[model samples]
Target: MPNPSTPEFAVVCRFQGLFPKDIGGYEKHRTRNGGDLGHVDPTRSHLNRPVIGKADWAARTIALIEDMKAENFADEIETLTRRRRKKQIKERMAEGPRDPWRATRHGPMREVILTANRDWFDALPTAAAREARAQAFEDAARDWLLENFGGDVVHARADLDEQAFHIHAVIVPKVQVELNGTKRWMLQPSKHELIKDYEAAQDSVGAHFAPLGLKRGERRAEAVRKARQAGEEPPAYRQHVRTADWRKAEDTRIVETRAELDRRTEAVTAEEVALEQKQEAVTGREKAIGAREDAAMAKEKEAGAVLAVGQGLAAGALDIEDRDGTPALIETPEAKSGLLSKLRARMARSSSGRARALHVFSKALARLREKARDEAKTAVARDTAEIQSADETIVEIASRLPYAERRSIGKIRVSLSARIMALTGRDTSRKTPAKGEDDESP
Candidate 1:
């Protein structure tokens, strides 16, 4: 026996074909006049509850077919009609009526019942709560019918007197027709499009009620297959429908699984974003450090160039009194031994030896002069290149420096001058003789 506290889960969507002969019998059952009180339980039925919410037994079914045709097949209707005269001499002609209802042989209407397991209602604590739930389910079922089935829903009612609260809706299966540029509608008797596949319909109904904690029952084929796999005797009932309680539990599990997956996905996405941000920050810091290092290296090179120039001047290998403030290489001690020194050395020799020595010394003096001139030019060129390189480095550093740092360029120049003076042991701040000016002894 099922527990009273536990709700049974079952979403039932069953369709019954309504032929011309079956309409009267179905109407009688809907009206509760056929003596089928099996659905009614006096102990369970709520007081003052209406048995049927809607009814329309006197509705003209044939007129509904004609109206559908007139609306959808106006052009085809004219083609099917013929002109007729009341008398041979009468001038008036009237169009004969077209009858499309004669063709329907099978399904004139469809009865769809939407219900849930009895245990679902039994689990509800109060009669009012059960009534509300049943009403909501009925409304949803009616909406589903109108959305999926393109037909006339003539009647709909909720049967609270039944074993389980259920909705019964009557639908006329009609299709729109277009012929000769005119719209027409016709009733489909052979095939009801909505309930063509019973299994597919059940699946759809299950999905519709899944949010409400009601799911489809198991299929007969699946139950048979499972029974064969288990090597057990098949149950008498081919279908293995789950109870309302079981369906509700399964739905809860599915919902929780989906929620967990979504949370994990969100977490992974957030982590990726954070990682990208961290990488970008690291890259920015590295670039900043690289720029600072480059500036420091350039300053070091500039200082080295200044120190080299100062060393050359202190060694007397270069003079710093040039017009453009650039250092110039001076004559070395070796270059001072020119033609005059050679002639003086040769003067003490015998006439023939002196003449021969003079000739050799003259050639040697010429080569020495040429070599000295080339050496002075090379040294000047090298010093000029080094100075220009240092100047370019300073300019580049200044351009890359921030606005606040750029203001220190003048201070940097002053520092460079002080460094040069300190290395050369010169007091450059004291007054000194200008280029080409003589220094008077006081």
Candidate 2:
């Protein structure tokens, strides 16, 4: 069915180029009179009838040959007398001068199918009426073929067994041409002027059906024509083949393509799996690095905390005092804050830590002993110098004193000398005028 905006039908005319090898198979498939068919309704096959001549292709070929035989083309067409098949002349260069691989190749035969996509015939009120219209439609197609193609339109039949009513016609292009420098006959269907190209054939067929109110089909080959018109290089042309052949070729191509795609997909999957394993290995290495960084950070934090505690002690905010030889807590309130208290508690945790602390205290006490000894030696040197100076002064001052005062000062000085020696553990006496010599006589 067609919409209101468009014509209710469009014409469809298809052409299949064939060789003698291909003709028998197509004929069998079309007529269903000799071969099997998949889509034909056998019950309705009786309705199928000849639109131009008989349904037999062989009989039609023979009759056509006889017609040509009776005419001026009788000798040229005698090549087909043996049969409506190829007459190959294989060249034998080894035996003669003819090329061995070279042989006469035949031009192809053409088959045309004429129908429309309109459901007008099927829209008839009754099956009998529909059947009558279908026949009439095919008859019109047959007449059109004969008028346009003449004797070349050898055989046509209406296939009513299919969904659409259509006519199949075989057209032979019998032309006389010089072959191998000898005159011979060939079926060069390209010689038909109506089918100069597919578009031309379609245009003529569409025009014929136009009178029946069917629209022309879209021009598929128009693009190629337009390209040529635009002065571009001609595109490679795709020759049309029978639908069955096209289907078979396409099926094989699709199967090969799918197999190639499957191989590529498997390769991609393997690569992806390898990439995932590599990523996992990289992730493991990253985790190991993170753990090492965490340990380093912990050590740094502990060192920072210990440094802060030492700074606090220098600021007099914290102190340590031995319980046996010292009095009270020496830390300021600032030093006993929650953070420092926690640090102190952590540091003083076990008996082992206490023992370590005691050993450290003993080392500090020994340092103090060395410091005290240095101070004591400085004091003893100062005292010894003072005592010597006093002894020398006594000798000078006694000479200026009275006899009595001299005797008294002498006794006191002697006592001082003995005490200086005892305290310093060294002699401190200075020389007195020989023992008996009087400073007063001098």
TM-score for each candidate, following the candidate numbering:
0.39, 0.46
lDDT of predicted model 1: 0.59
> lDDT per residue, candidate 2, 213-306, as tens digits?
6777776578667878999876677666655666677878999999999999999999999999999999998988998898676555555554
TM-score of 2: 0.46
Q: Write the per-residue lDDT of candidate 1 for residues 1-442, one digit (tens) a residue.
A: 5457655597988766565455666666556565344546656444313222234432555466657645544454444453322352132124333444445533556677788887786667997888778777876787777666744666666777656777777776666656545455655543454467677777788888776777786776567678989998876764322233345667789899999999999999999999999998999999999999987765555444444333433444323233353323343343334533443343333344333433444455457778999997787667656754675566566666665565576356446656755654557586432222222211
What lDDT does candidate 1 reach at residue 349? 32
Q: What's the CA RMSD for each of the models?
A: 31.9, 14.0
* Candidate with best lDDT: 2
* Segments in model 1 whose C-alpha atoms lie over 4 Å from true places: 1-8, 35-62, 66-106, 178-184, 189-193, 220-442
